[model samples]
Target: MVNIILAIVLLIILPYIGLWKLFEKAGRPGWEGVIPFYNIYGMLKLSGRPTWWLVMILVPGLNILVMIGITVDFVKSYGKFKLVDHIAAVALAFIFLPKWGFDKDTKYTGPSASPEFREKYKIALKKTPAREWADAIIFAVIAATLIRTLFIEAYVIPSASMESSLLIGDYLFVSKVNYGARLPMTPVAFPFAHHTMPLIGTKAYWDGIELPYYRLPGLSDVKKGDVVVFNYPMDADSPLYRPVDKRENYIKRCQGTPGDTLSVVDAQVFINGKAAITPLNGEMKYTVQSDGSEINPQLINDLHLSDLTPVNNTSFKMNATVLSVKALKGYSNIKSISPDITPKGHADPLNTVYPELFPNYKITPNFPDFKWNVDNYGPIIVPKRGWTVKLDSLTFPVYGRAIEIYEGNKVQVVGKDILINGQKADSYTFKLNYYFMMGDNRHNSEDSRFWGFVPEDHIVGKALFIWMSIDDNASFLSKIRWSRLFNIIR
Candidate 1:
């Protein structure tokens, strides 16, 4: 995921970062310009070089060598050529040349390069294959996507929120056949903007202008407990946020079916009041500090990182073992109850799974041992079709009216005041349906609690397995975590 982010950042920001460094080294102020070409001029000036060198940049053959020479000269003149930056600047042109031209800090002053600079430069570029590989990757991704979307789409995991099952960094080949492949959403959407119009898409032609497509419904019913991804419906006016004019996809495990009464008590999930037995509950994943050493956060009792609470900022918890209840209505924290899973050889005792239901108690949370957290918050019910719910009536402080409402043009908004297709609703009676999703590393994720329910359109596909599990929390090689690779997601 981080690599993907870095690649993407390099794509958009590299041009600017490269331009800035080049300009600064040329002795021009970094902020003096924005356009790519003008920035090139700035680079010439900062390096005490001439404007005439600009012609070489556009030239076809001798220009490549001249450009690399000039780039090396500028960096060396400005004292910005660290060992790595040199490799990035000349050898890895696609990877580093632009990056050198734009992003580095050319703020220092040093002498020019020696006579043998070009000879050494040629060798450095040959050694690091990441650049050439990056080029091949781009071509491969394009070719694969062209063949796949029109033919298997590739999916990459971005986080360990799906841990214990599918480790972060897992990649899967999602068959377009399963969901009957959705046509690209932004077929006509303006590049960065989501509102005005869509980019290249193939939906039906309504009257005159082009209409991008919406996928025909259902390859199969999205099963209960399947891991899925979908466009964020709460996406709207959020700055720098591209609307899901294209399907904005998110991956999460489905935990509810339409109309299933759901609740969380003591950090455990209860569907229709029966505790769910997730294969890896309270599983430990270790992370290392900035220095090269590992820290099993779950073992740090004082840190309280492991306490599953129904609320945010669990770092505030004082005692790992003491989750004292405060002011919840009709509820009192029962002390000394253990929520540890039963011994591996036997089934859990029934008492550990279900809390007693009562008439006065509107919320019977499932968590008996964890802190007050999202995984510990519900005993709340999910509404189904024909299930009439009164706005401002229930005690579900977590829910009301405004949810991830889609208004077209890939716009989505969330709040307490929204309606669907012109129907006034604080809550819906359900025209289609809704589902609940949660992360596997349950306690530390920002999920359904922050966003509203996951609507059907947002559904992607189940994450079936893990192909790789690189623990970001380990020594570089030790971080590979071989045991977790190829693990099956339950």
Candidate 2:
């Protein structure tokens, strides 16, 4: 509260003080510069600009661009048209205006923006080549940074979780505008580094000036099947504290939207009691049995079947896409090929169980006998904003992590009751919407079924296009996946 009050006071007082002195230096009544809209009018008159520019500054989004142009003109009116001067005009205006207006060495010379005035002063204020290059690079970084924050950014597929749909080494251009670009929570950070500072292996960002989660207007709403990029919410504090936007980025298909009931039966996803349509090209593990002879290696390459594990030579387990599964059936040496699906009621073998699955079913009593596994998971409803859910021993395990960690509330389970922040509570009203995300590689991917729901605040953007694709296994001539380049990601 005190910080907010201090910021408000500074916003009100600093501009008034700086602009008053600036107008005085321009031969106008200093008090006239402190009067809201009138101050803008005075500024325009001194810079030889029309009053219509003020209207242009009032429009949303465009106001920022128009105001920057006006500031450049104002700085030029004082005979400071250098790149550094323009940067000071835009970024340090509150301080720079006061310095320029009060300094005895700086004097107003009718606007220097005019070509005649620039040419006359060019010799005395000319910049060296090195300095000019530095200035250009600085400005370019700023422009690119703004576009990355507000429009789109390039991302690369770091893993094969979304195999066949999105592959490893595929370079993508993620569109932040699809689900609205999130304003960076921790704005001061090492450029181009996500979590670690380059070369140092230390933290990249400062959390001192953290901002609340905010998103700009977006092009479209996130839908059921859209491939979405989002911050890995689980990594918020695996080893160190990090802001929301700086967490690792993970891409997956949106399996369930808020308020939708979602479940997995025999490795197939279902939403609202109906089987969700799987992506046609999605890959899943399948057990393949061949005739008593070594399977042809060329056929395996043609089908793109990989990660083959031999089961007595005659049979093997491999991750294969739908098209690959169809082609494998046509091979004379192949006897049988079927999906490696776990039975609905059975638990995975002790060696195959992933202990980190959500709700951590291993904790007893709080979650007595949770038979749910990756293949036959919940009919749990995704939480929506303002929806209230009753809390008890049974329900607590399902949402305990969400309320305590993500929502930042203190929770306790006392016998049959639940306490939130030391107060006995029967229910919890979700503060944010949640979605279910999963990789296209059904049996191979680790996603929401393993970690849990993705809170709305963690959403990053829509996966738009694959700008480039490289195949590590291919020889030089075919190293580039020519067909995949420039393809729009569905």
Candidate 3:
């Protein structure tokens, strides 16, 4: 009890210890920085921010930005203008500010960013052989991390879900800034690990200080038919809670945006009742009949037909792009090629193999008759911010998981009546925008049709292009996909 009390007391007093010295350097009474609002008022005076901006401190999310701005200005007042200095001011202000304030040699020049400040404080790291290598590696990691977090990240296609449009082993540069870089919700995490730590198989992130979801202003809002990368929302089921940015990343085509009604009929997607434009490179699994002969290895290789499974001597199933399928039809041995469409009321064979699809929840008042299959699915309206939907047994199966899980609400069903958060409600208003994502290789991909809506917060960014592509099945010389290099993703 005494230790806990001491820790709490230390936490309360430590910030003031740093602030008092920092305040004294700013020509304010040292003791004044220990007071709550008075400390902020003193900071405002030192930062040169208008006193009216002080009111912003009371606001929740805005206060963080205001505090950051004020701190940056305070560091500028000390003539620290380098990017590294700004980073230190924002990230390690408590330690750095106190050190700068208390040190006899470190003096505050004025409220101006001076070029001389750079020369005075600039670190000249000792140039030993070991130090040179360490510095290079450290700076390289920092540069790569910054580029990944703020600009674009290198991604490898790990599955055939996108097939010819994007293949397994294809290296891509997903533009973080294109769809607005998502500020890390779990900032303190292992570098380069997604969800799990490498080798040891531990959680990759420390979820101790989770921040609310926020995206930097983007070049454009996600549009229908846009190739997108997003955190898998349903991964919320995987043992522990993961912040939005730390969840597993997935790549897919945006089938429906918020407010757009979406459905799949015979594997054709319709958005807002119009046929959505398809990607030129998009592919789907097809059942093809051939003239009872072995398929030419060269033909298969040339067309890049993935996972060609022989059903009989005369027929096979393969995932091929539209152009490849057209090319395959040139062979006289190929008789028929058509989409492997799963009929309505019947589940796809993958459904049996995969155990569960999206909305993979098992809740009471079970939606047993909810026979939504991949090829033929909802004409359901995609949930939009501020849109209200009548809640009942029928609609519950469609929107229940999102409302309860994603939106963080308590949903209950009592004798055919729906209640939200302990209150009887006939309708529920959506708090966040939602999106529907589908894979380009329609038949082979496990996507929104099998799962459910992807909340906007889960979106990662737009996939820009393939930087490199390699085919593992080919020889070393042929492994590199020369044509696919620098191919801009559509």
Candidate 4:
């Protein structure tokens, strides 16, 4: 994970210091580094390099190669070259320049890199020989692991499903404290790679602790209205594929805590008849996409809504619409209007949210499982061993699982398709237990809506803080949003 830290430091932390050195090293004013592309030219000439090098450096592959060489030469000239100097060349640009120029009190009196500077730079890194790759890999792995597990983990908001609550370009810090944290399920999380899976799952009360999140401690429990980041309930997405800070860990409000009966009527939220305080967590206004497509901006404006609000373009259902309902579309209603005022003026009445109320029903579990929806599945009273279940009481055509009561890890399968313990059972109880987790962006998310609840076995950790975030369009330098800099995830 040291590499991860280095990457951050070099990319973020070092620049401030390096920019100063860049000015001094160039023999120009210290503020030169703080300027735009001028620093590139300044550093190039300081190292006895050419202005053309800056243009080539802007090129993808060529720039990377040039930077590696320049870094070592730059630092050695500044007098910091040592065992770690090669890494400075390979990994540090911002650090080397500032430390050499501004910090070291050097001044840029030249137009470009001097021939002597380039020669010395090559010699410095060349002396280290084969250890370059090894050092870089070792440190990066250590940093990635530590950061991925205990500290804040970064993620991106993907779909517009959570339009009003999050934007496609938004990066977030998922606090792990809201839910009890889960130790690494997989023993060794290989740096930059997924090698193995962990053994013990989280406690029934500790699900969603899987990936990095808000839980700094293992004592907290996730409650309704709490925003959360969990493994995608569906398999269509992968966090790794997302951008470094933009990885897809959906940010959605917790509509239903475990065992909460979530429903919608006409559009307003009525929990056991009491209205739920309207939340802006699942709401947003419209904006244009980069592709020029019109859609909800998925922004969390910290604003409220009023009656007669209208929105469309995605799917939504009022999980808790205790407020007023105006224009309605598939599953979504307006939770916000022009600027402020929530549909519901009162705070969310936090209370126990139970599962859908249903009478006793029968089921025939098909082996290997069959296609089924959580809404229409047969309501099977959890079949305990002593309670006799009958074959005639089964409802068929649902997903099937072979009835296998095992001693430890081995479960026995009776038939490809059969009833459980004599009666039809929908879900099988585990030696541990299972959990149901769904994204608040109900329709747009690929969550438990498809694959089913997260078994206690798959939880990771709670998200904590947003370290960094930038959009695809923002400048590498212009994108840091200070308002989100250290905001807490409630």
Candidate 5:
């Protein structure tokens, strides 16, 4: 609250106070400088800019650029034309605006945007090649930053979590406007970098200033089956403890939206008691049994089988799509193929059973009986905004992390009682909607099944289409996956 008050004083009040003094010098009523929209109108009149620029100032993202232009013109009208003067006027306006307004040497020369003023001082305003290049670079950086933040951004698939559907080398254009562009929570950051700088290996953003989470109006809400990109929620408690927007990015399919009860039974997902549509190219684990003969390597390559491990000369475990498993059954040497699903009430033998599959298992007393695995887990409810749930041993393990870490609550579990923010509580109301995400490569993904729900503020955007796809292991001649190019993501 103190920081917010200081920000208003420095950014809002002080600048307007300086503008009031400047208005008196320019033969306008000082009170006009303090009014909201009228102050912008006054600046436009003083700078001799067209009234249409005021309309652009009212736009969301474009308003930033318009304001910068108006500020520079207003400074130039006072005969301050140096690059440093313009920088100070925009960046340290509260300090410099008052400094210039009080200086007796400073005077209103002429309207900088007027034709007569430009003609009289044409030689002084002429730019050298270096200045022209600098201006062009500055404009390009600002424009590109706004477009990347508010419209669409290019992203490269970094892992095979969504394999067969989105390959490791697929480049996609994620649309920010689809589910509304989230404003930056950590606003002071180095340009063109997310959390860390490349090569230098240092933090790229300053965490001293943080804005509240907010999103602009969007075309539609997040829907089930959309390929969505979101910040990794566990990063909040990771060693670095990065801010929400600066967390690592992950892409997964939205299997369950807010207000839906999601579960996985026998490796198949169900939402609200209805079977969810599976990804057409989604992969799952299977155990293949064969005669005492070597399975053909060519067959393995043809089916895009992965994680192939020979249990013996006769049995092998591998990941394959449904179609691949069907095709393998037709082979003469292959005896039978069975899905490698962990049955209900059984813990996953391969992974650490405590917290990886059942999040907050170590902290909640009732978690030991969950016995859930990636293949057979949860009729858990996805949290929706304003929805309330009773707090108890059973539901605490399921929703504790979201309430405590994600929603910024103080939670303590004492024997059989729940204490929230120093008060005894029996229930919690979700402050934000959450979605359940899973990778299409079911056996390989560390997703919501492991970490719990993804808060709405963590959502980045909806994946639109793949613009490029490259196979790193392919020969140079066949490196590009041409068929996947420009394909819309389902």
Candidate 6:
């Protein structure tokens, strides 16, 4: 809040203070310059622009361009027509405005935007080709930046976490408007780069300036079964302490919306007390037993089976989609295929080896007897905006990081008591909603079962469709996956 106030003072108030002096020099009342919207009205009148431009300045994305145009015209009215002076007037307004306002040599010449002034100084105002190119480039950058930030952005599937639902090589257009375009929390950033600059491998943004979380009104709230892209929650900790918007993006299917109690039993997700809809093309690890005959390599390729390992001549392990499993069952040599589910009482080998990978492992009073694995884990309630939860050793591990780090509350455990914001609290109400996200590649995904819930502010957009698909391992002639292109994401 203090930062916001300081930004307003520096960016707005200080420039208006200089405008007060400039207005006095133009034979207008000095007070008119500092009166917010009225000051803009006064500037339009002085610069001979239509009063309707004030409406344009009030708009969100368009307001940026309108203000720049107005500033340039206002500077030209003061007989400062050089491109450098216009640049300084708009970019370094806090310093340049006051400098020009107090300079005795800087005097009001004429309304630069008016027809009469342009007609009188037509030759002097005529733009050169280089100047025209510079103007065009500047306009393009500002316009493109606004579109990318508020409308839609292009993203590529870098990993197979989304699997057959969204392939590894698919190029997608994620619509920011689907879940409301989130206003940039870290406002000052490189125009095109996300978190880091390419080639240089350095930070692309200055995190010194930040804004509070806000989103424009959107088509609808995030729903269960939606393919969503969001900033990785774990990036908020340790070595990569990126700002919320700048964290690495990961796409997954939203299995549980806010306030839904989600759990996975024997690799099948259950919401509340009912079975949830599974992804049609989602893959699962399975153990396959075959008649003592070698499986055809062509059959393996055709089924898109992955991670195939021979346990013996007749036994094999592989990851396959439900459709693939059914297709493989048609073969005479295949004996049986069973889902490789971990029993309820046991933890997954990976989770057991790296306990810290599980979200709940960090709690002080650990659940020594609660051995939950990826395939048989969680009846945990997802956090809702206003829902309150009791703070105890058992529940702390599930919700502590959210309360302490995500919500910006100082939490400490003193013996058996939990202290929130230096006060003893038995419960805490969530300020933001959270969703449980999981990958379609069930056994291979490191998701909510590992990192915990994704905060609402971390959500980026919905995966709209695939615009292109490339099969990197294919021959040059078969490089493009034609069937996958333009497929709408389910």
Quote each prediction's TM-score: 0.45, 0.86, 0.79, 0.41, 0.93, 0.92
291-410: candidate 4 lDDT, tens digit per residue: 222324332111222122223443222322222122222223333422222222232121122121121112223422322232222222222223332332242221122123111222
Ranking by TM-score: 5, 6, 2, 3, 1, 4
Query: lDDT tens string, model 5, 1-490?
Result: 5556766777788898888888888888989999998999889888999988988976777888899999999989888887778888987998998888888888887789999989988887898999888888877987888888888999999987897788889999999999988988887788899989999989989877666688988999999999999999988985989999999989999999999999999988999999999998998889989996887888887888989988988999999988999998998999999999988878686455234475656656545567788999898999999999998778888888989988888888777888989899999999999999999999888889888899999999999999999999889999998999999998
User: 74-121 in candidate 1: lDDT tens per residue?
Assistant: 566545445456545554444664544544453445334443443444
Tell how far residue 50 is off in model 1, in angstroms. Answer: 64
Report the CA-based lDDT of candidate 5 relative to the real structure.
0.88
Query: Looking at candidate 3, what is the lDDT of residue 37?
Result: 85
Steric clash pairs (candidate 5): none
C-alpha positional error of residue 292 in candidate 3 after TM-score superposition, expressed in Å? 0.8
lDDT values, one for every candidate: 0.48, 0.80, 0.78, 0.42, 0.88, 0.87
Give the Cα error of residue 18 in candidate 2, in Å. 4.8
Candidate 5: worst 10 consecutive residues by lDDT? 350-359
Clash counts per candidate, in order, are 45, 0, 1, 89, 0, 0
lDDT of 6 at 55: 84
Cα displacement (Å) at residue 139, model 6 = 1.9
Candidate 3: tens digits of C-alpha lDDT, residues 333-404: 889898887887686675653444544434444554555567778777889999999887677878988999
Clashing residue pairs for model 3: 358-451
Which sections of candidate 6 miss by over 4 Å? 28-36, 54-60, 85-95, 98-105, 350-357, 362-369
Residue lDDT tens for model 2, 1-490: 4434544444456657877887788788999888987887777777777888889877644566677777777777787767888888776666787788788877667654556666777874588998789877975776677678778899999888898899899999998888888877776687778888878798888765566677888877789999999988778656755677888889999999999999999878899999999998788889988886776889878777878988785888999998989888997988999988777667654214466366666753556555676678888888888989998767777777778777878888787778899999999999988889999987777788877888888999999999999988899999999999999998
Best by TM-score: 5
Using TM-score as the yardstick, the better of models 4 and 6 is 6
lDDT of 6 by residue, 257-304 (tens): 999999899889999989999999998889999887988888887888
Question: Which portions of model 5 miss their true places by more than 4 Å?
Answer: 1-11, 98-106, 350-355, 365-368
Pick by lDDT: 1 or 4, better one: 1
